[model samples]
Target: MNDILFRHNRPDRAATFEEYRAEGGFQALQKALADLSPDAVQQTVIDSGLRGRGGAGFPTGKKWSFVPRNLPGPRYLICNCDEMEPGTYKDRVLLERNPYLLVEGMALACYALGVERAFIFIRRGYELAALNLKGAIAQTHKAGFLGSAICGSGFNLELDVHQSAGRYICGEETALMNALEGIRANPRSKPPFPAVKGLWGQPTVVNNVETLSNIPAIVAHGPAWFKALAATPEGAGTKLFCVSGHVQSPLCLELPIGTTLGEIIDTHCNGMRTGSTFKACIPGGASTPYFTKDHWTVPLDFDPVAKAGSRLGTGGIVVFDQSTCMVAATLNLVRFFARESCGWCTPCREGLPFVQHTLERIESGRGDLADIDILREHVHKLNYAFCALAPGAMGPVEGLLRLFEDEVREHITGGKCPVKG
Candidate 1:
């Protein structure tokens, strides 16, 4: 209820550095610099149970710990602001409101990881967010929060923003690293993970914008306090849910991590529009599986959503109404994934388009019963691709086959899209 990230935000414009500092902003960074050790700050995060808000949902501190502290080189930190996911705009909104939060968060993170140089890999379209961050970084440097010997302590950090040329693949960590390195944006092989070797063959740590922004709050309030902010026992801290589509009032709001999908739609969003009744919703972003009425009460946390057969990816809730066609909707999503593919792997490069073609046949009334089987097969096959792109792209198709097979059949057998008619 205490609005951790948006506390200092203003509706008209981004909160200035003075406004953010006035409301106890850099206290966390000061505490870490003056009192807490890097390990201690990391331990607090691990205990708080904060997971990445960047779709994968990995534990934040655990990720930081993977960077070998003994490694004899400059460790790097990357703030992943490449928010290209469809219907997901929480990071952009957060930065537009209070960019200082991220600057402080990144500084704290850099201290914790012993990182001196860091980059904010922002998407190209987010010019305002990028501008706000650059201004915030300058303010922080002027205030002795960044640059060498920050806060009169021995810690040093230099932050820079790298605006991307805009590709969906850049959202992937390794692919992002490649883009930042001025190479083709394709995912690199893991196990020499980023924490082990990254960014010109140095130890690197990449964190999502929302994940890093929550650091100050977690530090200000103890881990237990942060954990208690969630509505469920397992969940920790609040989540920024960006609701879109058929809802009566579509907007982004910060709520407890375990808030129910039904609560978000009916209570927060004021339910579906005037005449539209809830048909189905993408509980997370475009890549997550569809959630039907049965999952209304399911908590929108990582584990709960996963158990319900969908990921709580980026907390981008896209709602659909009764009149919506699942086949057409899925086709639209598949088309996006197909277009955005980096063309590296065969399955993602070739299979996604094939899947799109099959979906087209079904949506256009030329599909056969055998085509249903073909779609199902590709759903499994695409999972074998190099990265998550193909598997994620197939999510809606899998959901369509599982939940809306009847409707798909209607399109096929009826020789036309029933919803369109």
Candidate 2:
């Protein structure tokens, strides 16, 4: 049994209000609300360097500070619960096991951001999570941690849990805001990021499930203590890496961020699956680029992984054993991107299918050298054509061409997949 920060206190069943209270859950909020000023709390988190756990590793406290605190209107603290990144399931686990952790985290964020109303924009697929969070919210309200006049402290705050239609695009904060407003789930252009103009046109502070969950701890443990939790200069605290695909043991383990890919694979994942040699891994989730066996020694931080040709997206470590076909794998992931494209723009809507068709042609043994050129061309053309979706779709394509160029060339030279037939 490994030690987990959030899940450590998880009971046999869902954590009850009494159980969570006994486990020292709401004490941080009480301390934060009572002793520290909102700016002080935000500064503590900023000093701690707690980055967003969602694919984008923006600093959580910094993101919160972007809200115009002095400009008074109805601000919101939105908990982004849309966990649709392929091979990424850690957020779901966090929400599933301990709903109160998220609630407490949200409360801390509300206090830090000075937002009166908060909403938990949960994905439609996460019915159980929604149910659990709703129950937890009710418990919090009853316990005086939520609703107006929390904990006898004159602060007025209210929290509501809303279900989204479960579109991947809705995971984007702006798109989520639009969905919450009872519109179609499509991403809005940024510049007026969610911090400035968000849910119901309020200065909103949006955070991922895991990102919000980190707040209570950061508040409880001072900034210095939080900084000490990290193995690198980047930040503090362990990351919940969702290890999946072609591994002997697939599970989520909270490890220090600077740990190497190979160490994580060998130790946590029990090495690769039997008869399968480690070929490459998507250090983050599917949206990040791939890393070959040679790059395994690199630390799995946002900066180091980027230097090694990948982003540490969501800390979702998906290892691909040698038995997997790189071309087929790209095709599979592209198909997902194409299907989930909100059809808002040309690049993601049209370019994705074109890329998908090109990969399908290659995998079906009907590909030519021109197909490779077209794939590269389409990726270049589609780069940044829409939201991050287009660029994310290009990650595996670009990674495949960089690392597995020979395998792709072999596919064209042999007029068939070398892996099969």
Candidate 3:
């Protein structure tokens, strides 16, 4: 396992701050503050071709570039650590192992963008991670890596670890900003993206926990070295995949970006559990479309997964065995999304519930043949929801219709879950 992001997972406990520093942890920040210009740091990331790990594969550097550097009262940096996406826990794992990485990385980001303050919007459920981060913050503050004039570089950054009363929508950057500001966690419409105006109407950059963690390495090593870390030429760096469901050994594994799904399953996960055969898998998180055995060979990367009719969302893999009912599985996922709706828009608020009902009816053997068509229509319509939440909510259902249409029809015709037999 060529693990870059998660190379130092100590089963005993998280590495101490001194141990991290001794192994050349904060050297990246030191280099950034003393040697490189802000533009230089940003350009290094851009050149490395690092894309966001949090669902959307937006270029991290481009997202940073959107922050209007000049016209700002108090430009802010936020790490979206409120990881509530179903089947996704890479951020939580990263923080549990080493919260210092995120701190160092965010500090580098603040310097790169000339921001004086940053926030880590962590989930309340992640009590351990939150505590570790709080400890890391204190250690950094005392070590002069955080707070006013960090490392004597005239870069003042105050770090706040906000253990959010988390909702799934708070994972959204704009909604996270709203939550940080103590407003409703509903997503704000993007015309002025967060980079232009966010977190108190100031220029901001909201990056995923994993995204920020990559900054230290990118700054420490050159872009070419980072780019070369991937198995695929087009892909950059390693991706942490939280593998779960029917896999024999369910655990998070860090593989080079663009590692094939088959490799991850056969090697890291040790394939499916006993008495089970691979039927389907959610290639990323719950919000991504499903992939079947036919797609086992597909590369588990952003572009390739999209090309395979799913997404590399959070790089979390949820395996499904042959005994699983697609309709029921999708229904369970849809229910979580429906319940997490912020009620800011109609399609997510109204559309998801209706979709969930239809799925339940079908799964319960009460569905009409016409209900399948209704689900298809709803999937298309929900894509236009105010935020990506609604569309994301439809991903599994869409996969069911596309990949398991025959199974859905069987449930209607056989009057029960046919896959059970």
Candidate 4:
């Protein structure tokens, strides 16, 4: 079966509503509205095992069902379009090429979650995506597919595009909600989960752009059809793996979740550059652990990646060849984490710089072994701070220390960067 979601992403003008409808878009919406019950819709998604494609691979249907069905106030669905992770930019492609797919998906999710108002929280940096999405929103509203009495089904719905003042922390669900409500972007404590006390203290469901894009498909094809799309035992469905760095073909390729890292490199990506040996890859964006050449056999999925002591974060497969210095690579990643820190808590704000400085010192061959110990200690102390930022910041640092200690030692003993003059 042809993968429909990314099929329209080539560099021409994006498909508008009329073009999308001509290509069988919104048939799923009509089917969903006319045939499926909200509970049935939720159940179909659960059975499909469609995990969120965002950094956190939370189960999608389960996240939606968290909203109280009978509870009466307004419920909201927010599509998280803040794609700020380093080495990750697939969401931008999705939003830019097929804004309607995301809108259709969000509308379907709103139907499933008993939500009437939905917002696509787009990042300000993505000016094109923001503009495209706003135009799509207007089209959706005018076509009777959105707004009051949608599709003549008497199901009133409203979809809006809200631009976020580009901040990495705003990608977090709670922080996204807080920002939506005109507050500073900071993560709210859980327990009174967003399903309960969310945006304006009402039920809210915040899903990643890719996650919401799967909803219309799930509703169109029954759960079994969607489940059979995956080539792995973990689940079904094709995923967009955005590969970058040192690879012969660096682009976003859609493959089944069970596709091996080696297949992706050798087949889709045309392997690492001709002279470069594949030293390692961060299987899933910046937060995942470094997978050595030995892990080429590991399947690319949430459970398998985690079983191998890493995660399939955002499905960003960043390749590193032999010429890349591990010490310098680690320093660069640490710098990203430090700079993106939201300053909401002390650990992320204060500790990240400390970690970055220590890593730079050790990598530059001007530090003691005690620096490694301090790095480890501070990572542990800082990781559990207020949000996922600090914890996520530890990923590359931990992997660098654990997987390439000898490389660090080599740099230290040799008194300079191994890859540099």
Better of 2 and 4 by lDDT: 4
Tens-place lDDT per residue, model 4, 231-321, is 7876678788999999999998778877899999999888889899999988888877799988898888888888888888999888999
lDDT of 4: 0.85
Whole-structure CA lDDT of model 3:
0.89
TM-scores, all candidates, are 0.99, 0.96, 0.98, 0.97
Q: Model 2, range 1-421, lDDT digits (tens) per residue?
A: 2233554455445677787788788889999879998889889889888888888899887888789866667888888888888989887788777888888888888888888888888878887788888888888888889888888787878888888877888888888888989998788888788888877777988888988887788788777776777767775677889999999999988877778888888987889888999988888888888899889788887788887778999888788887788999999999999999999997778889989998998888888898888888877887767588889988999999989988998888888888875
lDDT over C-alpha atoms for residue 146 of model 3:
88
In candidate 1, the residue pairs with backbone N, CA or C atoms under 3 Å apart (3 or more residues apart, or in different chains) clash, namely none
Error of 1 at 327 (Å): 0.5
Candidate scoring better on TM-score of 1 and 3: 1
Q: Which residue segments of model 2 deviate by more than 4 Å? A: 1-4
Give the total clashing residue pairs for model 4. 2
Q: Which regions of candidate 3 deviate over 4 angstroms?
A: none
**Span of 10 residues, lowest total lDDT, candidate 3:** 1-10
* lDDT by residue (tens digit), candidate 1, 1-421: 8899889989889998888889999999999899999999999999999999999999999999999988897999999999999999999999999999999999988988999999999999899999999999999999999999998899999999999989999999999999999999999988799999998899999999999999999988889999999999999999999999999999999999999999999999998999999999998899999999999999999999999999999999999998899999999999999999999999899999999999999999999999999999999999899999899999999999999999999999999999987
Q: Write candidate 3's Cα lDDT for 195-283 as tens digits.
A: 89888999988899999998898889889989988888789998999999998999987889999989999888888899999999998
Off by over 4 Å in 4: 9-11
Best by TM-score: 1
Which whole-number lDDT from 0 to 100 does residue 158 have in model 3? 89
Q: Where in model 1 is the C-alpha error above 4 Å?
A: none
> lDDT values of the candidates?
0.94, 0.84, 0.89, 0.85
lDDT rank, highest first? 1, 3, 4, 2
